[model samples]
Target chain A: DVKVTQSSRYLVKRTGEKVFLECVQDMDHENMFWYRQDPGLGLRLIYFSYDVKMKEKGDIPEGYSVSREKKERFSLILESASTNQTSMYLCASRTGGIVNTEAFFGQGTRLTVV
Target chain B: AQSVTQLDSQVPVFEEAPVELRCNYSSSVSVYLFWYVQYPNQGLQLLLKYLSGSTLVKGINGFEAEFNKSQTSFHLRKPSVHISDTAEYFCAVTPSGNTPLVFGKGTRLSVIA
Candidate 1:
């Protein structure tokens, strides 16, 4: 089984604070993703990295950025946390197979910004 | 661009009752379809995926879905549902390559005693 480990399960931050959510995959997958889960809007991708030091913006990447300094680790950075950014964060990774590879997900981190 | 739409926001059914969750997608290129179930506060788990081959795809926990090309729909179904099946179901799609999946709003399944 593949393992995607998240740095924290729950976090509380004040408004205007910078936050970092780290993720690491042991399977050496080539693709890593960060997503935010809200009540009505299932899971929306914030950022994704296909290789080391390579990142792409997803549909909702306005206030978020990502860093992939290594192949096994991807990080999501919230430049300035706000109350609206409080939600569940998920990390997923997939291999670079020719066909579509199923993404394996982390347990998710519930973030609360007050 | 690819997008997925789950028709029902919530579906209520009694134990052992049949249920269906409708999903539709819009994509200009050939895509891959997937059904994922999230239990309570847990993360999403893959229930089934339609890459190609048969139109009817069987998945874990006695769930299955059929792919309709003309309708551009992939609807999940189960003959008899259990209380454990109550969860949030999401439909997602992506192009036929290594890319991120576009997810729908999700349908909440509530099973009564």
Candidate 2:
């Protein structure tokens, strides 16, 4: 089965603490994305990587950064976790092929900033 | 850039009743549309996708969506819904070429028995 795995399913951090959310995909897809899933905002993209070391900011990139050093791993970093940053984070990877463009998603990481 | 709009934030329906979740998109480039469902506490799953074929596309769990280019809408519908169908539905668009998808705010479908 195709899989996108998030290293942490749940996490808690103190305010102003640095946080790292890891994601890995076995599909070897060219496109990987980081998204924040809020109650009503749905999946808001934070950042996406189209290739190794190549990244682009999405609609909401403030206070968040992403790294794609390898083909299989994409990481999201929060410089200073805040109370409002508490939300479910999702990781997804999609193939570049236009014929088959469905994305595979990870289980998700629920982070709470105290 | 492409953007998606889900008209309803929530839809409450009884079991076995028909349902429709509306979605509209804005984009200048050609686009591929998708419908995804997310159960509580889980990741989103692809229900169906419209790449570039028939306007009416059938998906998993007896759900289907009609793609209307004139209206720029792709609406998901099910003739009869089950309790298991209660979940959050999202509409997404991928503008032609190499680009990530843009998702709507989502529509919550609550099926009451």
Candidate 3:
């Protein structure tokens, strides 16, 4: 089965702390995405990487950065954690070079910034 | 740019009853549409997708969606829903490119026993 794995399921961080959320995909997909899901906001894209070392800012990219050093791993970093950043972070991967494809998502990491 | 709008925030239905989740999208060019389901404490799963060809697309768990070009809607429907079908459904759209997907807020389906 295709799989996308997240490093942590739950995390708690103090304010102003640097936070990192790791995601790895076994499907070897070229496109990787990070989204923060809120109660009513659904999933707001934070950042996405279509190729190694290539990234694009999404609608809500402030206060967040992403790294795609390798093909299988993608990371989301919070420069300074804040209470407002407490939300469920989801990582997704999809095949590139085509428009007709669906995304495969990791279980998700619920991050709480205190 | 593409955007999706889910009409209902929540829908309550008795078990074995039909349900429909409305989704509308706006885009200048042709787009790819998808419906995803997210269970409690889980990530989203693709329930169905509409890339092209036939407007009527059938998906897993007896769920189907019809793409209406004139109306700019892709509404999901199930003949009879079970308790297991209770989950949050999301509608997403991406234009004909390698861009990211834009999602709707979501519709939470509550199946009453």
Residue B60 of model 2: what lDDT?
Answer: 97
**lDDT at B87 for candidate 1?**
96
User: Which of the CAPRI classes, incorrect, acceptable, medium or high, describes model 2?
Assistant: medium
Per-residue lDDT for B1-113 in model 2, tens only? 78899999999999999999999999997789999999998999999999988999999999999999999999999999999999999999997436888899999999999
Residues B1-113, candidate 1: write the lDDT tens digits: 99999999999999999999999999998888999999976878999999889999999999999999889999999999999999999999988557898899999999999
Ranking by DockQ: 3, 1, 2
Find the 10 residues in a row with the least total lDDT in model 3 chain B: B94-103
Best by DockQ, which number? 3
Q: Which ten residues in a row have the lowest lDDT in candidate 3 chain A?
A: A94-103
lDDT of 2 at A62: 99
Which has the greatest lDDT?
A: 3
Worst 10 residues of 1 chain B by lDDT: B93-102
TM-score of 3: 0.98
TM-score, chain A only, candidate 1, equals 0.97
lDDT of 1: 0.93
Error of 1 at A21 (Å): 0.4
Interface root-mean-square deviation of model 1 in angstroms is 1.3
Cα lDDT tens digits, model 2, A8-109, are 999999999999999999988999999999988989999999899999999999999999999999999999999999999999999875555888899999
TM-score of each: 0.97, 0.97, 0.98
